[model samples]
Each structure stands twice: as C-alpha cells, then as structure tokens.
Target chain A: NAGVTQTPKFRVLKTGQSMTLLCAQDMNHEYMYWYRQDPGMGLRLIHYSVGEGTTAKGEVPDGYNVSRLKKQNFLLGLESAAPSQTSVYFCASSSDSGKLLSYEQYFGPGTRLTVT
Target chain B: DQQVKQNSPSLSVQEGRISILNCDYTNSMFDYFLWYKKYPAEGPTFLISISSIKDKNEDGRFTVFLNKSAKHLSLHIVPSQPGDSAVYFCAASWGRSYKYIFGTGTRLKVLA
Candidate 1:
C-alpha cells in the first residue's frame, strides 16, 4: 500500500531559507505526526494532527509549523531554517480507533535535512 | 525533561544468544509502551509492545516485559541473529494520547 511516503528524501538548506516537507499515507490514518531525531536525542515530536484540518503543538514545536488540510497528507514547514535544525525528520501515521493495534505507527523512510 | 530513557547506547550479543534491551520511563501515567527497530537509512518499525495491564507480551522470537512498579520495560530477542542487528527505540504514551515520547535508541549488534 506504500504505507507512508515522504517527499524529498534529502535536502540541504541555508540559514534563513524556507522549505516544506510533504508526507502522504495510503492507510487512511486519522492521526499524523512530525518528529525530528538528533544524535543521542531520539525522536521528538514537533507537531501532530489528530485529524484532517486540525493541528497541535508537541514536545518541541519551535521553529516548525504544520498543516493537515487533507486526510491523507500532512505538511511540515520551516519558516527560517537554522543549523540546529539539521537532523533526520520522520513522518508517522496511525489510527485513533482506541484499539491496541491502532497505537502502532507506520513511518516513512525519513527525510534527512542539513541546514548550514 | 526526558520522559523515556535507554541507558545503553549500544549492545553486542553473540548469535544464538539472548539479547535484552532495557528502557525506563519517569512518568507513571504511561499506560502503553512500544519498541521500534531501525536499520541504517530506514525509519523505525514496530517490534513489540506491552500495556500496563499485562506484564509481558510475546510474539515469535521477540518478547516485551513490563514492570509497572519499577516503571521499566524491556525487549528480549531469543536466538539473536545478525539480521536482528539494528538501533532499537522505546516509546511511551499515556491514556489515549496520540503522542509518544521516545528514548535515545540503543544500537544492537548481533555478531554471527
């Protein structure tokens, strides 16, 4: 089903440059999330959407913005890229059916971003 | 504050041996815990999980154990093989929260 897919597997941006990351899922999940993984820091949530047309801040939402206009797509935007933003970003989707299996998330291959 | 923690940065185990990875969480509100495995250049995949109501959950060669009192959980892989080598992450979530707090991954190296 291609599960979840993320655009631009890799990218390099200069400080103050802006760009957007796109994520798509074919599973019709009701929940979508954006997370960044830094060396020895694990994956920290930047933002998440409980459903289409809704978004919420997470553990580390600074320097990032998100939008979920459609049920199958979620987008993460960087208004002003910075060197500290260099990391591997992952997009994940899951269902919110209150079922045990629903808690398991499907992730994309990840987008490696480097901001200089 | 780091809610979830994987103390060991890396672990190595001989083939056919048991590989146990440990995780600890600071929040008692966490009712569900999960383990994800990631290979180089790939995203993390679900491995196994355990809920607060159950002490253990087993699936094929993988098993997850939860000690509620200690606020600790562990993933065990029996007869570890070279193919099982990867970085493992532990995540925790409370109630019906869709957000998960992840721990710094622990890299596992299974030597054949």
Candidate 2:
C-alpha cells in the first residue's frame, strides 16, 4: 500500500500568495486530518474530516481551509499565505469504527511550507 | 492550554540500555494514550498504546505504562539500539473523538 502521500514536499510562498496542499491516501480510511507542526509546539490540528464532503475546525483552523471532496483525497488551502502560516504540514488518515479511540492514525511524509 | 506535556525535551542513553520517556496529561477524560516515533524527515509512526483501564501494555521491546492517579504515562524501550534514536510524541484522546492532543515531543538518542 502507498499509505498516505502529500504533494509539494517543499514550497516557498510570498505573502499574499495562495496555494493548496494535497493529501492522498490509499488505505481506504474513513477519517482524514490536517495538522501543522511548529518549532517548539507539537503538531496542532488545523482541520479534519470524518468522511468525504465533511470538514470541521480544529485547534488552529484560522488562515486555513480544507475540503474532502473525495474519500481518497484531502485538500488544504491557504487563501492568503502569511509568515505565521509557515510550518511543516502533515496529513493523516484513520479507519473509524464508531468506537471511541478505536483507530490509529497513519501520517504522510509531510509538506514543508515557508511563507516569507 | 497544553493538555499533554512532555517535560523533557531530549534524552541520551547508552546503547543496550533502557530509555524511558515520560508524558503527562491534564485531561482526565482521555481514555487512550499513544506513543509515536518520528525520524527527522519522516512522519511519525505508531509505536505503542495503552487503554485507560490497563496500567501497562507491552509489545516487543517497547512497553507503555499508565498511572491514572498521577495522570502520567511513560514509554520504556529496553536494550535500546541506535536505530531507536528518534523523536517521540505522546498523544491522548477520549471516546469516539478523532482529535488527539499531542505533546511537544521528546528526542531520544542512543549513544554507541
């Protein structure tokens, strides 16, 4: 299995530029999540989807948007890139079985985004 | 507020010794705890996990111990190898909640 894969392993964006990060998973997971890892802080959830077409705000959802148009794909968009938005982004997938904490997450390699 | 915390930023252990990484959580509602190992440029991989009901869970050379009273958990790797050097993250989550609160992560290095 390819597991989870993310696009644009590295990128540099100027302020005001827009871009999207793509995440694709072949594990057929029912849940998808987007998280950003900063220097001192742990990975913080930006947005998540329980399934396709559903998205919800996480701990740090500001300045970012996400869409799960397809089960195998999750897209994270930066409408207007800012310096503070620069961080290593990771995408994860899990198989939810309706039981609490029943699934373990599989993460992608990650995308390093630098906004100057 | 940081729900999960890993006080130690890094730890150094001699080869073939035991490496103990500690993690604490303030949320009593958390029913599950997990440990993830991450290499420098790679994503974190699930190492081991334990449920609230169980005080200890063991898998291979990795063991996870939970202390409910202290709200603390730990990951112990016995006979550590050089390949085991990596960043370790602790995560907590409650029933049916897909969101996991992660700790700042502790870097473990095994000295040869």
Candidate 3:
C-alpha cells in the first residue's frame, strides 16, 4: 500500500503563477495535512482536513488553499506563487487525531517547489 | 512566537555512545509531545511520543522524557548507530487540536 504519494516531485514557477500539488494515501486515513518545510524552520502546517470534504486553516495558511474532495486525496494550491513560497511541501495522513487514540502520521516523499 | 524550539542546531556523538537531543516549549497547554526523524530529501518519520501524564516512555533504544514543570522534553538514544544520524524534530499539540507545532530541528551525527 503506497502509504502516501505526492505528485510532481519538483516544480518551478515564476511569481504570480499558480499550481497545485496532489497527495494520495492508500491507508484510508481519516485525517490529512499539508505542511511546508523551510530552511532553519521545521514543518509548518498550512492546512488540514479532519475528514473527507472538511478542511481547516493551520499556522501558516496564508497564500495557500486546500481541498479534500475524496477520502484518499488532498490537494494544495498556490493561487499566486511568491518567492517566499519556495520550499519543500509535505503531505501526511493519520488514522486518528491524537485526541483519544494517538496515531503516528504517515508522510509522503515531499514536493520541492521553487518560486522565483 | 515559535512555541517550540530546539536550541541545539546540531550535535555529534561517537558510535556506541548515548546521544541526547533536547527540546523546549513555551506553551504549558501542550499535552502531547512527539519526535520525528528525517533524512535528506525525504519526509519526517515518527520516532517516539509521550503524553503529559507520563514523564517517560521507552521503545527499545529510544526514549522520551517530559518535564511538565520545566516545559522541556528530550529524546535519548542509547548505543547510537550511524544509521540513526539524521535531523530530529520535536512537536507539540494541545487539547483537541489537529495541528502540531514543530521545533526547528536538531541534526544528529553519529561518528564512527
């Protein structure tokens, strides 16, 4: 089971250009998240979905949008890319929300984006 | 505000020795703490975790200790192996929150 997979391993976009990154998980997880990893900064959550069709903004959700149309798929979109958006994006999924049952999240390889 | 912080950017330990990585958080409300290891060009993988009710949790050679009063948490690796060398990050989450705040990350090197 490809625990989690991300599309477009690498991409380059100019300022104001738009693109979307897709994430798919075969584990049938109930929760999915999108995070950006920047130099000297660890993973910062941009958006997350507790269940299919439900989404929420995270710590650094500005300049980013997300949609969870299917249970296995989560999409992150950059409407107008900026130089600051250049970073590695990671997608993860978990069976539980760590409230009562704490489950470790499974992460995808990650997509490297460079916005010039 | 950087609620979670890993002060040591990097650390090196000799093979077969004990390696300790530290993390501190400013939020007392955080009850769940976790540790993750990441290699170059890859996503972070779960290492271990501990709830606030417990002070220590052990899994094989890796253990996590939490000091609620000091608001600090640490990961200890015994008999460190070269394969264990990687960037380690500490994360924290509060009640009913779906998000976790992660530390900057500490790079560990097990030297032979």
Per-prediction TM-score, chain B alone:
0.99, 0.99, 0.99
Q: Which stretches of candidate 3 lie over 4 Å from their true place?
A: A97-101
lDDT of 3 by residue, A1-116 (tens): 77999998999999999999999999989989999999899999999999999999998999999999999999999999999999999999988644562557788999999999
Q: Per-candidate TM vs. native?
A: 0.98, 0.98, 0.97
The reply for model 2, stretches above 4 Å from the true place, is: A97-100
In the range A16-114, model 1's lDDT, one tens digit per residue, is 999999999999999999999999999999999999999999989999999999999999999999999999999999986576633889899999999
Candidate 1: which stretches are off by over 4 Å?
A97-102
Give the true-contact fraction for every prediction, in order: 0.63, 0.63, 0.52
Q: Cα RMSDs of all predictions?
A: 1.1, 1.0, 1.3
Query: Residue-wise lDDT of candidate 1 within B82-101, one digit each (tens)?
Result: 99999999999988889899
- Taking chain A of candidate 3, what TM-score results? 0.95
- Ranked by DockQ, top first: 2, 1, 3
DockQ of each: 0.67, 0.73, 0.65
RMSD of 3: 1.3
Candidate 2 structure, TM-score to reference: 0.98
